[model samples]
Target: MTAIAPALVPLLVTLPLLGAAIALIAGRHRRVQITVSVATLTVVCAIAATLLTVVDLGDQAIAVSVGGWPIPFGIVLYVDRLAALLVMVSSVVLLAVLLFSVGQGAVDNDDDTPVSIFHPSYLILAAGIFNAFIAGDLFNLYVGFEILLVASYVLITLGSTESRIRTGVVYIVVSLVSSILFLSAIAVIYGALGTVNIVQISQRMGDLDQDTQLVMHLLLLLAFAIKAAVFPLSFWLPDSYPTAPAPVTAVFAGLLTKVGVYAIIRTETELFLFNDVNVLLMVAAMATMIVGVLGAVAQAELKRILSFTLVSHIGYMLFGLAIATPAAIGATIYYMVHHIVVQTTLFLAVGLVERRAGSTSILRVKGLMKAAPLIAVLYFIPAVNLGGLPPFSGFIGKFALFDAAAEEGDPLMIALIVAGVVTSLLTLYALMRAWNLSFWREEDDSAETEARISYLGDAPAASVSTERRVIPRIMTSATVGMVGLTVALTVFAGPLYDICARIGGALLEPVTIGQLEQEHEQSTGGDDKGEER
Candidate 1:
């Protein structure tokens, strides 16, 4: 079990930032931009994968001090087993989305898309996501969120259509509100503890009065909850997400909200340590599961349905986090990975469906199973996996989570568990409905049916018609690659769950702040002696 070099830490962020700059400079040359973006992310993925292996082999958390300052004063990039695994998965998803976007751009011939701005902004977005995963301090995490928000705002509104602009406004406004709350919480925490370093704060948070701690806890959780789109705060997601281009929607659905979930995980396990808010989180989890899936059931469009289901699945993650047990947290980790891949694959496949059928509305699209069997397979695999069908990662993850919850044997836990099962069933129902309408059902050719009137008594067209559009091979291939990763998750569920369980256990173990401080001092002392000599 060898340790990864700390030198690789800053590169995880700096490389993407550098790639963004190069991509911006090469904006006029789309091929150049694509080359640079792909190359940069490829390197990042390699580093992240290596780091994950190292951490999973029992290496301790790898910390890098930016520009050689000591711990409390300097920015740190920390990669433990959990952070490393997230970075690896995120990079893989980013790369796949980039390829999908590039392919879509090439096929569309750039009329409706802003190829230049998209490349650089996408890279910057990836940088922010990676930064968030490895940040070792509260302030740094906030920075990560701001970086992502800026890039996402650009990416979400890339097409500059009227609907996209409107939804982008909603997305940005919600993000700004969340950011403001997060910054305020950071300021108050710094004022109280005098340090925003996570370990330092973890060491001193117990000293705060219970009332103050509760205030801080609620403040942080409130902000993350909004970001995670849990239940009551989730109305914005379904509306904002479904309007974006498919690649944009896919990445946003897969990664952005999970960043919020990651923050909540850090807060509960690292910062607050399972405080009295478990009941609140549990209630929110149950409501999120039920309400989100119900919304999915009512939607007539594929992306909207997926968007609502996205909100629903966040409940499953919250369910595990609320439990706060090692097994529960491990299950949460597994589910997070599964959701990121399956959701992205589903959305990407939906993009293909839209390309083939001219629209994503279930009412408009029909007979895709007969028209595009490969795309149907691509969509079905992820759809069922997301619905927690057996012999898939989704099923494996949900089973682990339910087992953990039932072990608690509390009334609330039992209730949430039941909600979870119902949500899973409803998710499958909603998705299968879309599948049947958009793929299985045949359009009618009868003259009477063709001349059907509008509900408002307006005359209809002689017959409803659909023209299947060209789906680029590269676009389909990229989607297939993502779906393959989802299948791989199921195939390798055993080892992945083991890794997640170890990470969860490690997260619950307390850190010795004094020992960390001593190590920082010793390292700095060594640097000073070397300079003196």
Candidate 2:
């Protein structure tokens, strides 16, 4: 059982790859596509849970070398508690999206159902995430990123609608460019250390002058900042994500940028463990949050507003990262788990709303209370939760973050706390404003929109539901999935906090980081001695 944890990491990546292949072969077959997708994700979830169990039993991170090569030679895969937890959270949301997609009848005829392409692409993305999470080396991380980007390009451009394409061009260009930057940084890292293994790199970095280390750190950060859609570098996100298909957007909202943040957190702990690097992270966090919410307030569309909020909330995580305390980092990790599920849920719900109401633009769509009561409740719960209202996961996550900041003396950190509160308030206002237009107010129905809508041989779900029930059953289920996650994060704060604490100890102490490097050296030294003998 203990030995299995390391092997399980590769299985997590492989299952998604297998599913993507099946999805590709069965593109026109909705039943096959959905079945393969759901089953693959389900298995991934199980594997992640098991990995978590392994971590609970011991502090040792599961490690395996591909092609029987040790670290710094062949590719290496490893999973600590941090990676396992993220995988678990991701699997849950992926399952929910799969369920919601099935419920929506998004796939019908083999020809009409693009789910074939979606399945393979989605799987590829998941596989990339698994690889990145477990990757023990820099080059391996790059492989993971390329796979994710390739898949994301397809998903973002799925259905190939005019708007999606237009936005996708910007998205594709920005993403590709970011990838190139990341590649360049990796090359530099390789050149600098003569090895691209993360543990080895950390050891090499410690030998370098502070300025050299700073340069490397900054370069790596620039790459992640682009992925994170942090301020100034984030203009491309709000433009592209909202126009993509619902599931694509939902996955993007929940997974893509967060990957960047994960990388930042990992690098910060491994490399820059000494100084208050949280200051830099803090500045970025504050900028990302304030700008994100402001953009949300200005947006007149539903999906777009959510997109801004998605970017904005990234700040809170950064805030915690910036503080660099165990409590702060733990809160950051917890917040990420909460955010991924809730955001995905909200995106799916909004997509359903857009289809039912004939538009995502708030100016064009209206009256959720009158339109779909279940959906109204769905939007309301996440919308308010996103605002970080008490009892919601968002609130719990933020509360942990701010509490950590309170322990610090930096005025900048203090300001981050205040900004976090303000952002939450404004986030609420923007969500509520959109809510007012889309679900509460009445609006004129357009014939063009109606013609594009397929009622599945019946009237729209929105046309029938009364205020008592709110949202449709399918949409309601999707909403429930998201709200349930939010509640779980809120309620499970104790254990979750503990997991985060352990991860922080791992990161801050970097004993694991040290152990991996020393072990690599000892292995190499033994080989040298054997050859000498």
Query: What lDDT would candidate 2 get against the real structure?
Result: 0.78
After the best TM-score superposition of candidate 1, give how far the Cα of residue 216 lies from its true spot, in angstroms: 0.2
Clashes by residue pair, model 2: 27-116, 28-110, 278-322, 368-439, 373-470, 373-471, 374-470, 374-471, 375-470, 375-471
Candidate 1 has an lDDT of: 0.86
Give the runs in model 2 whose Cα sits over 4 Å from its true position.
Answer: 105-113, 275-277, 442-475, 512-514, 517-533
For candidate 1, lDDT tens digit of each residue in 1-533?
24235668789999999999998998899999999999999999999988787656644667667877666678877788989999999999999988888888897776445788988899899999999999989999999999999999998887788988998999999999999999999999999999998888888998998899999999999999999999899989998987787889999999999999999999999888935589999999999999999888777678888999999999999999998899999999999999999999999999899888877877677778888889889999999999999999999999999999999999999999889999999999989978977788666634463243122122121122334557777888899999999999999999999999998898887565654554333434445333323
The residue pairs in collision within model 1 are none
lDDT tens string, model 2, 407-516? 88689888888999999999999899778767876556666644543232131122322112122466457667777777777778788878887887677766444466
User: How many residue pairs clash in all the candidates, one count each?
Assistant: 0, 10
- Candidate 1 wrong stretches, greater than 4 Å: 1-4, 445-468, 515-533
